[model samples]
Target: MKFLKVGRVAIITRGRYAGKKCELGEGLKTNSETEVLTEELQVVIIQPQDNGNKSHPYPHALVAGIERYPSQITRRMSKAKQTKRSKVKPFIKVINYNHLMPTRYTLELEGLKSVITAETFKEVSQREEAKKTIKKTLEERYTSGKNRWFFTPLRF
Candidate 1:
């Protein structure tokens, strides 16, 4: 099974939100009489706005209603396949793990406020700082051509 945890920040490497960032929301578990110990490992995520909005455009009700597995959230598909489904699919799309790049940052879950202490916040801050330093170094060393960046270039 893939290693995943709630609150981890990830970048959508494919789909409409390819360049956008997201955070793990919650995980789904399953229980059965046949195997009392076996569990289904699935996850749901929250795609935060790039502009850092106080409230996400997608309502909390919608987010809570959808049950997206990790496989659905991180799967990569070709442009042709994506176009085929675009017309009929729902506005909110699930991404795949292969398409998500987990960043060094993680958002604090409101439900876990009591569990996440000051020390956890310090660790998150340190990770954010490290990410900034890494980004700065990468920016200094790498230059992208007009159409060479990972995300598809938008045409006017």
Candidate 2:
């Protein structure tokens, strides 16, 4: 189980907002009461402080509708797993196929490409895409004799 540190909670009481997908901004404040269209409203459970108790009453109706889930308990169980991980030896090894062993020379080769293509190469922030490029480049270099593949260890 994974515990998410809740930053804020939202409880929407009426209209289309009366659904689980209501927008919740992070903070605690009494939002001004808008004129209710009707006394009957569909309450959407928006946000929870560790999953709010439905029995608890608040100005926000959304909080009152949130059914308690077993997630909080499940999250506690996973704590042991997380701690045990740091202590136990990792059976699965992370092999960087891009490098024989990511030593100084391999790292230097990667850095040199970044420096050379300082104009055309954009510094991409997405990690998955970056990794994909690196993996593709490695595969290409492993299969083909190409200088471009050599310089950019991360380029697909």
Best by lDDT: 1
Report the Cα lDDT for candidate 2: 0.23
Where's the lowest-lDDT run of ten residues in candidate 1? 61-70
TM-score of 2: 0.18
- lDDT tens per residue, model 1, 1-156: 133345555554444445444444332221111112221111124322222223322222101101111111113887656434322111122333455566565543244322222232245574345334423322232232211121122232
Give each model's whole-structure lDDT: 0.31, 0.23
Question: How much is 15 displaced in model 1, in angstroms?
Answer: 0.5
Taking all chains together, each candidate's TM-score versus the true structure is: 0.30, 0.18
